[model samples]
Target: MRKNKLQRQASTIDKKFLLLSLFLTVVGLVALADASAPLAQRNFGDKFFFLKQQIVWAGVGIVLLFIASKIHYRLWEKIATIIFFLSLFGMLMVFIPGIGTKLLGARRWLVLGPITIQPSEFLKLTLAIYLAKVSSKNKKLAAYFVPLILALSLIMLQPDLGTAIVVSTIGMAQLFVSGISLIYFASTLALGGVLGFILIITSEYRRDRLLTFFEQTRDPLDKSYHIRQILLALGSGGLFGVGLGQSRQKYLFLPETATDSIFAIIAEEIGFLGASILIIIIVIFVIRGFAIARASPDTFSRVLSCGIMSWIGAQTLLNIGSMVAIVPLTGIPLPFFSYGGSSLIALLIGCGILLNISKYGKE
Candidate 1:
């Protein structure tokens, strides 16, 4: 009977969810190897440096996923506050002298010797978990909303509007699914939109991005260069593409080829068909994730699953929208696909939590 129970529990795990995540991970690794080759070689004198590091991180993420999947989902609720504070501490460390690392005029990373991390990445995950726990208890809006605002203020100070937006969206989405009043929901969303607009227009670089999105001809080789190159890469892909690993743009012409603009490179190499396949996979992941959320056995698990789903789905939309010129480029990393260790790890861990919840979901 004990052996049979073990087998039954194993069967309750979401195999389709795990398979889709693995599929995306494999695709990301292959695409990063191709997209980062030229950039990595030029900067580090090694074509495979980034790819090798990414593989190591992916291995670590997989191990973490497995461990997290086996743990009880309820355990997170007990420590959600602790995790949030710890995440905040890490984010604060990024502002300290001699520890905070600045790149491209933004202070967003904490560099501790050979290990550098973006605390904001982990903060997003912890924030979602914290909010879900708070909202699950039917707490006052201030319980979740005020703290989220505080977090957003710090994130924006990092001058990372992309991450700030994504984090805020994830938190708000959790509140929405937690049975918040309709009036409160509409007001909060409107407020968020206005605040986002103000944040964008006040910052020179962000304002320029917005302006460039409207008028690409204003600064073709400067402010607008990234978007134009992205469009060119997509257009060049045509129907089938230039073929995998044959992209010319990765050779220093397109900016952020291996990071923010990797999707464009994918399109340029594998064509429209390949890009559509990726988009479809993401769509399916979102649908099935929500299905799990709906089937959750309790409020905390339901809210947590919904929050995680929003983080992945919203970020994916933002990244893809920027590349396609629908939204102004926000420098957001595509989940599972972007070449960032912290992002991939946080995402996989979230998936593991969702999987664990699936086991106890209402059948």
Candidate 2:
């Protein structure tokens, strides 16, 4: 009877998490419909093309999440190391000339026959699983000093500095949950800050982005075009916005209107009020996620919850921050609001894992 009661309580808690995930999924599709309509209509002669694709991806993601939620979360522990190594290989494979396809200037995607996928997206999920599993055992190191440095090293190699930083933070959080010394944690933060500074200085493009952020008006037509446009969109959004699907910027006025800077586009069309509502929804989702994490029965699931929460929450912040020029352009999509099939699937799978964690949570 006690076991049954515990299981029922867990199921109830999990339902809340599921509803939150579903909320984000549905809202993302609706936003995508607005964000992708102009470009889809212009290119495909159909306004719903991208929206249809988003809906399909969302469906696939939900299914993937369901499967993940049903399975025992411990299975991830058994294969965590293997999964980490596989993702490492995938990250390395992105640099292999023909096998690795470089779009723009970054060689970040791999082509596997009909599928062209971003390994970093998968990296976010797998790294979380691996870190959670590994740290769940070694209480001292996991809670102490290893996670921030070790995990950050692997992520930085991808040259995905933003993700590397976020992943490092996630690992550190897991360590903290495991009971780390706060003084050492501060030192780790300082070290990461210095390393990030060094990486930014050594990388010319990143340096330019930092400079452009400060002097956007100085080079309005040059390196600062995207920054300037994103700023205009946000500024133009006013309080009530210009109205949905009526964004003047989407008429080729903003670059990556459907991808990286979609939030700015959303702000422009829907105004501050609409953006506030969206932010509230995301905040509620994050709170629910943390609730599930805290309510979890064991250490691994707690760490798992932390990892998953960090991945989605961090990515959302990076995407929106980059769009608004509060930070450098990370080129990351706005969660479900952006247009990437692989990204959507990976994210969904991660959420599913979280749902599973909630279902098996402790009393």
Candidate 3:
């Protein structure tokens, strides 16, 4: 019986999901090394500075992934509340003097001794787990929406609108998977839309981004330079590409080459063919994730799985959409591919949980 049980467990693991994630990680590391070389040398005096940091984070993320996968996922249900509050506390720390680090006008990182963290990333993951655990029990908007609003408010106050949007998307996806009524979902979406519009208009910089996205003004160099540069990078690669490690734009022609605009650099270097392959890989990841969610043996696992998939899907849409000029620039990072220790680590751990859930899925 024990041997059969072990065999059952082994057979149930989602190899497809695991393989796709590994593929993306390998692709991300390769692309990042190529994309960050020039900037790393200019800023840090080393061609591989950013690449080395990312490799270190990747190692740390792999270790966390193993631990999160080994821990029975149900324990997340027991400690979800504590995790959520701790995430919120971390968010608050971003405002503390000397501890909070500001970059590019946003105070989104907290320096805790030797380490720095972006709490919004942790908030996105923890909130998904907490909502999955609670919404599975309560099944009401009042039960989950209030805390979501509180979390969003805190995140937005950090002026990290991109992370706020991602967290909200995860919460709404969880609500839908929990069987919330259509009217309720519709109402929630509409309310969110109105609130988003208000937030965008109230901030001068956000308003400028919105305007730049919709209609280019007299000065392209001021507000819309980034978008125009992104278009130039993408368009320069007509069919195949300029060739890997040969991106012209990476030589100070474009900004954020290693972060938000990394996809554009990918396109510039590898052309449409390579970009399409990356997109196809992401599509496979999302489909497998939802399939695992559908096969989950319990409500909590199913809902959590849905939330995690939505988190990745929504971020992908935002990041790619902005790159192709279909949406405004939001400074959102492309999953696994973007250069950020916090994002990659949080995402890998989330994948670990999803993998653990897959083992218990209905075969």
Candidate 4:
């Protein structure tokens, strides 16, 4: 007899993964409805244009989650290497002219006819699966990590420092959970940090970002403009906010209001309490994710759960930190709340994988 495999599946199918996604998706839609109103009204002549797009994408993501949730998480282990390589190829494809699209000087998107996809977004999940598979094969390799660092360099070549950092951090966290040699981990960490710093400081734009972080007021009209305005939005919110749909900042006063700075609009609308609650929900998600991972039966599922959780949690923290002047800016969005169809889809799929893992996780 399979002993209680069937019972476990029956019991765990709709556990924390479903619950967290439900909370996040609902909250994300609500926030997007609020944040996208001003930007949509100004750009699209409709208050709900962006929100509608998000709702459609969320629907598609839900379909994906529903489909993926029924599949076995172990299948990811089987295809992880192939997916990783294919995604790496996709990342490299951005260098090919005519095929790649550049919006603000940096090329990071692939345009195929009428459709475009950001490879870095897919690369995050690919790397997560690859790390989980590799760690399962040999835990020692987790410590002497370079594959992710190399991929980060490739992504940074696209000049997308934000995605690279998120991908790299998730990879590191996966390795950390694998319990590889600490000395090797430290060596990889120091080397990777030096390389990352070198890469950042060497670039004129990135260096300007760093310098702005140190003295934002020095270049108020230049590099620091984004930071200054973001801080102004945060400060203007004070304790209670400026009231719903009344943000003066979104009226062409803030850059990337629909993307990197979406959280600012939230702060400007509902104040500090709202932001704190959002953070609390994210923390709850992380806690539940790790608990499921820890409760998993197999090494692959364990690492996979950790990888997915870290991917969302670390990115969320970095996004919020950069928003409020706690860290250097990375133009990453706040997961589902940001106006990106691809990001939302990828995240929901990742969440689905977590659910699959939880269902079959070891006791």
The lDDT per prediction is: 0.90, 0.79, 0.89, 0.83
Candidate 2 clashing pairs, residues 3+ apart or interchain? 297-362
Top candidate by lDDT: 1
Query: In model 3, how large is the Cα lDDT of residue 27?
Result: 87
Tens-place lDDT per residue, model 3, 1-363, is 967875687446687898888788888999999888888989999989889888999889888887787777899999999999999999888898899999999999998897788889888889999999888788666779887998999988889888888988998899988988899899989999999999999999899888899975536887888999999999998789999888999887899988999999999888999889889889989999999999887889999999999999999999999999898999999999989999999999999898888887776
Instruction: Enumerate residue pairs that collide in model 1.
Output: none
lDDT of 1 by residue, 228-315 (tens): 9999999999989999889999999999988999999999998999899889988998898889899998889999999899999889
TM-scores of all candidate predictions against the true structure: 0.97, 0.92, 0.97, 0.94
lDDT of 2 by residue, 1-363 (tens): 998886786564377778878887887787778877788888999988888887888888888988888777889989988887788788888888888887777767889896688887887787788778767787566343453455466556656777776777677677667556898777866876887799988998889888887788867887899988998998999999999777888777788877887898899988989998988888778888888789777888898888788777888888888876778787778887888888899888887887877776665
What's each prediction's clash count? 0, 1, 0, 3
lDDT (tens digit, per residue) of candidate 4 on 1-363 = 476776756456646658778778888888778777777998899989888888888999998987778788888889988988898998899889999888887898899896688888888998898888888886566332667766787887888988877887888788888876799778878887898899888898888888888887977876899999999999998888899878888877888888889899889887888778878888888888888889877778888888888989888998899999989888898887888888999899988888777776655
lDDT (Cα) of model 1: 0.90
Runs of candidate 4 exceeding 4 Å displacement: 139-146
TM-score winner between 1 and 2, please give it.
1
Q: Rank the candidates by TM-score, best first.
A: 1, 3, 4, 2
Q: Is candidate 1 or candidate 4 better by lDDT?
A: 1
Q: Residue 121 in candidate 4 has what lDDT?
A: 85
